[model samples]
Target: MADLETLKARKGAVRRSEIPSNVLTALNRGEIETVNLVEFLAVDHAKLFRSTRSQLSLDDKSAKLIAATIKKLADVGVMQRLADTGQVFHQVLDGSEDREAVYQQLAAHPSDVLRNWAAYMDAANAKLTFAQRLKRAKPFAIDDNMGVREIAWMCVRVPAADKIVSQIEKLHPFAKHKNYLMRRFAIELSRPCGVWTKHITALKERPEIAQPLLEFCREDETKYVQDSVANWLNDASKTRPDFVETLCDRWLSETNSKHTQRIAHRALRTLRKKADA
Candidate 1:
């Protein structure tokens, strides 16, 4: 929600075109000290620069410079401040692979910062090979924060799905994770059609992969997880109406739990309407 003037000011400025860069530059140039940077980012996040770092399409040079600046701050004993501010961490991972190196330096830092950083780092754009990117992102997909875990799955899914042998089979184990978010993450990733992401070109025969996820989620208690499960089924109904109808009809007949029944029924709404017609 950056104001017009603020956005205009950012558009042409080579050093800090994005709000995150503006804040980072101000700290890097001594215009504002670390304390001021923290106040501007973490505590007083007013409406002026509400755009997250990912929204700002920063040029290569600026991203590298900001990565260096973040490293500088960490070296200067203000690493905790960088970890504390969502904006700071957002910029750190905003399409820049260099930020991964910075995170490596702060590997022993708090989980909050690591999880936040893990959420946005796009390994596909990294300088490393595909294997290396997977190596880098694999551990974070199970991060403590649900959002972080979701994001980590996103970073690896496309590339890994296309390249890895038996990728869906390998990922099935995540459904058994203790945290409901990780379980949800596994279900969503196995989706036949991408939600916002590119369609899984490799998963041509979709129903085989989708069935297990639906079964695993049928008994889930977390409302958030159930919602995702419902959405996943809804997405499937568009291409596999028969499969969805059959699954829902079976689940409805077998399960008496209101929550699971509600989700399954909702997912089958389109097919049900078609059947009525």
Candidate 2:
């Protein structure tokens, strides 16, 4: 969201007349592969102030073309300059093997390294393809808050039901994250398409993990989680009345939300139908 004036200020003192044509061409085609074009600038570091030894001894027209190209690339979000290093960085927005590999590398590293790497990657392009990114992201999920958030977002983008179920099972161990991350993870697993009976049963078996979600439902804090729980209960109640009745009774007795009450009523109805039949 940077204004033209702000972006121009960041570029600093580079006259429109000092840029190169090849650089301009690369920028126009959105093919500036290098991170910092400034590094490739014509200035000669060894020969101080020897303007004659620069890479491209350009005239006015060539320089203007280069400047315009840089401006256009920056405006279109193809590249960003790192404030700390003052290096121009290019990000791959489209699905590229190179970009996917970079995320995989980041995912394998430790948390601190991963954070810096993700920031660098994000600067290059904000969105990533889920399938390409998830293989690397899965391991990092249990290790860091940022990783958990990234994995959660990645899970939502997965189209395959089996993949989603596997991811949920893998991430279930990290259900102990602080509220912010925990809430997101919980909601992601609660999706209708993502649900698996085995996964829910596994979750229910672990009181420590299941307890927080039950608490959230009892408190009626997140409507998404509540709705998910209601759906899960209703589905389970048809085939597993004993399990459903146990959970419904436990939750209804402990919490007072209208949603929980409604869930309890549904469970009771299911039980009565079973008894009458």
Candidate 3:
């Protein structure tokens, strides 16, 4: 458990000529806390730090020193890698104190780094807990369009159905952003037998909000939304025959191609069979 003082002291011992002046000063003045060090290494030197083997054009001594510093920081539980992207991947760690501290230090001030780090720390080891991710996702919903996309992708990656439902609920308010997030959610939900019935019921209650998702399912679109709507209709056909028939008829009458019309036709046939039975 390395604290701020320990990190600062260690950083001070490094030769001034070896390290950058600002970085050295940040250490000597105690300005480089553990959070600051973690974020700096994670963002600035992340590729070098995480590499199993080094490729940088530096002497062995400098590379070893830098690598040693990164290992020490990681060993102290200040930073962690959540997943591997083969070449490189995302790392999540704490930030300095708040937005202001980060803004003054990092190049891209007050950006998605904080939100991403927070979410990653919350769920890094505990793959089952989505509480932290959900809470962080809410704030990002109001700002940062890219944050919304990242959070939406996170939801899809989680294995739990309930977490997916919670993600959809959190992101529903942002459906009007026109950023392809809502459509992405709809596509994920449309997978057959992937999510629980309770999740499907929640989506059904917001047809008005979800209407835009239908457009993604058109024949020439080639989006996941298209097959997703078909899957949703198929699922609804099992129990809500009348609702399925009505929705299918509405979709069929629209001026879309026969490919899309075929989906509606299939739903109608299934509904008719269920009605007769």
By summed lDDT, the worst window of 10 consecutive residues in model 3 runs over: 84-93
Model 1: residues with Cα > 4 Å off, grouped in runs: 1-101, 104-122, 125-147, 163-165, 201-205, 272-277
Which is better, 1 or 3, measured by TM-score?
1
Per residue, candidate 2 scores C-alpha lDDT tens digits across 1-277 of 2432333234322543545554333333322221233422332211211221122233354334433433444333211211111111113223434444444443343222232334444333435343433433444344454333433333333333344444444444433345444544554454332332124443343323344444454445545445555655555555555666787788878777787886567536756777899
- Alpha-carbon lDDT, every model: 0.54, 0.41, 0.42
**What's the ranking of the predictions by TM-score, best on top?**
1, 3, 2
N/CA/C clash count, model 1 = 0
Candidate closer to the true structure by TM-score (higher is better), 2 or 3 = 3
Best by TM-score: 1
How does each model score on TM-score?
0.55, 0.33, 0.37
Model 2 regions lying over 4 Å from their true place = 1-181, 187-217, 262-277
Candidate 3 Cα errors over 4 Å, as ranges? 1-185, 190-201, 204-212, 215-220, 265-277
Candidate scoring better on lDDT of 2 and 3: 3
